[model samples]
Target chain A: MRQPIAQGRTQKLDSKRHASAQEILDAAATAFSERGYAATSIDDVADVLGCTKGRIYHYFRTKGDLFIGIHLQALEWALEAVGPTAERADLGPEEKLREMVHRHAMHLMNRASYMGPAQYQIEMNLASEGRNKDEQMARILKMRRQFEAYYATVVEEGIAAGAFRGTDANILVKAVLGTINWMHVWFRPGGPQDSTVERERTAAELAEFAVRGVVA
Target chain B: MRQPIAQGRTQKLDSKRHASAQEILDAAATAFSERGYAATSIDDVADVLGCTKGRIYHYFRTKGDLFIGIHLQALEWALEAVGPTAERADLGPEEKLREMVHRHAMHLMNRASYMGPAQYQIEMNLASEGRNKDEQMARILKMRRQFEAYYATVVEEGIAAGAFRGTDANILVKAVLGTINWMHVWFRPGGPQDSTVERERTAAELAEFAVRGVVA
Candidate 1:
């Protein structure tokens, strides 16, 4: 009975540690997004986490490492949210595109803090005097290419299915993705309209425009 | 003779001061582009200018002010570069679009430092901070709307003249502009081909695509 109790306590401690790390990441994302990477400090993140800088150091070796980890995790979340919809073989290409747009926009609107930081770091911070700069950049570029390729595949399939035009798939993909990414820079959570309803409308309009451009 | 001499001296001093400010702005543009607004400091700008922080402060009030100035100046240059071509009444809509694309691409590629910072700041930083934030945003949105309105007008004219199909002009304008702005994010100067040549090809392709999409 004592052995079991000891094991349960260890499990609880592990869970607590995991939760702490997550809190730190959340805090870091907000700081990085608002103040930018260079201006934000470990202490700032720790303050938000209600912890000490040493706690952050225990989990993240360096600020650069933390930022890169944040970037990858954000991307992973985005992919998980949209990737499965894209992979549904039973859905038609148009439907897949629509679902992808809806999910992508919804994720961005709801998770703006997480998504916004990833964008700021990638667009503004990664190349600046960061640790493992080259490796980090390569990883980012690779992930971007993978994401683009995924979009291109969808466009290509749509074209083959007589739903999209035989236009250059690469350019079309870029246009669609660029419009979506640009949303992070401007999208607000709550203005006058419901965010979910507005996002759905925006996504639907964008998808329709894209389909029109690519469809024969 | 003394008056002329004094006037010349004053003129020379003013020119020298202007030259220094231009130099500092140029250096700051590069640093901001490579390091971003947050990671970069007045000292970094001064370092790039091969001067002291006092030199930077001599021309601009703060880093934020300097960044906003650079961003506005870059937009001014872009407007000057593409604005005339867009205003030409002799060219048809297709030709005008082609010219706008070529000039815009050339400007971005050649002035990547200034243009990149402006693009990044407009899309990300402005929304995140103070410093005439609302006014700057309104101005930017106005400029964008004007640009899109220009495209929409052309599309409307083309449709009226029976030169194009009846597509939603606003949506088409947004798609094209989104594609063009997206270039600033990913376009590199050169690889196996000259950047000028690539710009022309891209411009031509986009023009053709837009024309094909709308043309009757």
Candidate 2:
């Protein structure tokens, strides 16, 4: 006799599958960071997650899809981190920029598992063998431009108010954002300067240095 | 029967082989740039050079060797660019640091084919399945430290002389160098801002921005 499947049970199983997919993404990021995106295999990511290759393929059709997924997650978190500051009405342009940078730095250092490899998306784009390379890269680049526009908005406002030195807003954004982005390359968790206090100090230092570069 | 090889002819052949090897390295860098290091193959490099794979193998036993070779070339160029400025006793620390950053930015933008992949050495190390990972990475890191020391020495002297604001010389060095190191990602030779005059202006802008951040 066949038993009817319960709708409630199916929904529970769906949630569980979502959780497993998240785990796969996390494992993939770690493997990509350790083994380089090209060198890392689906089997390796499965091994890290203690799952089968079929399970990974269930969610991601290819390794490039998984890499892009991780990047999207990181970009979402980054935008989320700074979105509130960008929207705050009470803060001046400099304060908004300062808080935005501080939040982004903290988000990068804290969630570096995804953020580290996310910064390497350009490299991933170069190596992607996916059928959808152009479409995927265009989407990612669009998100990146939007992310950059946040800072550009602040810098333009700062210049208008005579708060920051007049410079090419585009170049200035790259210079400061480059400093923050480089954090993933040098700052390591559990390394010599990896304590909570040290991480906070570093975030502060980076924010101060970056903000000072543009202050009038 | 084959005639005995002439001594002068043998030497001339040796030099030609050396020149061919240099061409392979250049071609490899371009391939690595277009296709990330892991995705790039010796066959692709040989294709770019219109030569056979055996020719590349004659100079580089493995892709990792060729990758490291590009890195060494770029590092040598970078050190060469900054070394003269570092040694000029006539210039003050501020002037030396300014000139050093300017030259390095120019080198990065001009020789992006090599410098672009050189900065991606960290990614290469992750992807490298070569047996020489330890030795190659150690050599590269040693050279990187030496390259960084040029900027560090100038920053230290600037701080000591009260010419620049005091900050952690190491962290400050990373911040500014990160800005310059990031040029390869955004600057393109044939892009709208790729004119020689624009390249020079961008270099000056970056150097000015970096040095201004430290001025007391």
Specify the highest-lDDT model's number: 2
Model 1 residue pairs with clashes: A165-A214
lDDT of 2 by residue, A41-123 (tens): 89989899887898887777667778877887888889999887888889888788888888999998888888877885465
Candidate 1: segments with Cα more than 4 A from true spot: A1-13, A46-55, A91-95, A130-141, A157-167, B1-16, B41-58, B81-106, B122-177, B206-216
Q: What DockQ does every candidate get?
A: 0.30, 0.47
Output the number of the TM-score-best candidate: 2
Q: Give the Cα lDDT of each candidate.
A: 0.68, 0.78
What are the per-residue Cα lDDT tens digits for candidate 1 across B58-152?
A: 67665666776676667667777778887889988767766776677667777878877776455545555665556656666676566556677
**Candidate 2 wrong stretches, greater than 4 Å:** A1-13, A123-128, A133-135, B1-13, B123-128
Tell me candidate 2's fraction of native contacts, as a decimal between 0 and 1.
0.34
The total of clashing pairs for model 2 equals: 0
